[model samples]
Target: MNRLSRVSIAAFALAAGAALTGCVVAPVGPYYGEPVVTAPPPPQVEAVPVAPYPGWLWIGGYWTWQANRHVWVGGHWAAPRPGWRYVPHRWDPGPRGWREAPGRWERR
Candidate 1:
């Protein structure tokens, strides 16, 4: 291939790779910042069962916006990781709408 063609191909490949892997990129700030005018409150969660094993933590359920409405995702047990704590997702009202803060593990 000519020099120009090779450069174009390289640039195209880089852009494609970035686009494909875009979902894996972490948000830059506290939340995604996309908001809705309003969102329903989280559903009532069932009692948490006994931990399957020691050192497991119960992550609570939370409401997620879907199909232009709020959806409930149930809670579950998660194995505790060394030097990390699980932060649960939450919804907070914003000027434009309800901002969703996704859950993540933070270093202790």
Candidate 2:
């Protein structure tokens, strides 16, 4: 009986881990913000180092908050390293309004 209980407990833990692996954690706060009337300055582009020899791509800016969740500043575009391409940040409008997606990199 004890061995059976231990097996059940292990199986339950494994199942729970597998279930959580597929679960998505929603952002803690509200998703959308009020649209701004005036557009901000063009995103600043900086020359970030490619670091290693192969070099990883540079992606566009992101909106990150300082202090609290009240404000989100935009990210900037950067020049690509030797073997990388810029992936632009895209915003999707759905029932929840704007959904900001991060940039990705693909081998050239």
Candidate 3:
């Protein structure tokens, strides 16, 4: 291969390796945020798609607070926790407002 062709091939290999490192093999815990005053609207209906891998489950989406407003985050399939169950993210009503509890995997 010419010098230019060799350089292009090397760059392509590096990009492919970087992309493969980001595979989601398991569910990750969510980040917490400040509470919002406005209550979230009803959850939107979503059609669960096929799992990327076997044993994955559809984790339904929930309302999230951003910029003091409720936003709809779409749902997706997640790799199941072998010895644990997922606690869904939710916004609980409080005296100050709605407090957001991040989703987490808990031992069964």
lDDT of 3 by residue, 22-73 (tens): 9868655334655567788999999888889999988899988765567889
Q: What is the C-alpha lDDT of each candidate?
A: 0.81, 0.53, 0.83
**In model 3, how large is the Cα lDDT of residue 60?**
92
Per lDDT, what order, best first?
3, 1, 2
Question: Arrange candidates by TM-score, highest first: which order?
Answer: 1, 3, 2
For candidate 2, the C-alpha RMSD (Å) to the true structure equals 6.9
Residue 43 local lDDT, model 3: 91
Among all windows of ten consecutive residues in candidate 2, which has the lowest summed lDDT?
Answer: 64-73
1-108 per-residue lDDT for model 2 (tens digits): 699999999999999999899889866753334332333334556556454444334454555322333233444334455665556655555563445554666567
Q: Poorest 10 consecutive residues of model 1 by lDDT?
A: 24-33
| lDDT (Cα, tens digit) per residue for candidate 1, span 1-108 | 899999999999999999898577654533365877777684676799999999899998878777767778889999889999898887778777778887889998
- TM-score for every candidate vs. truth? 0.66, 0.34, 0.65
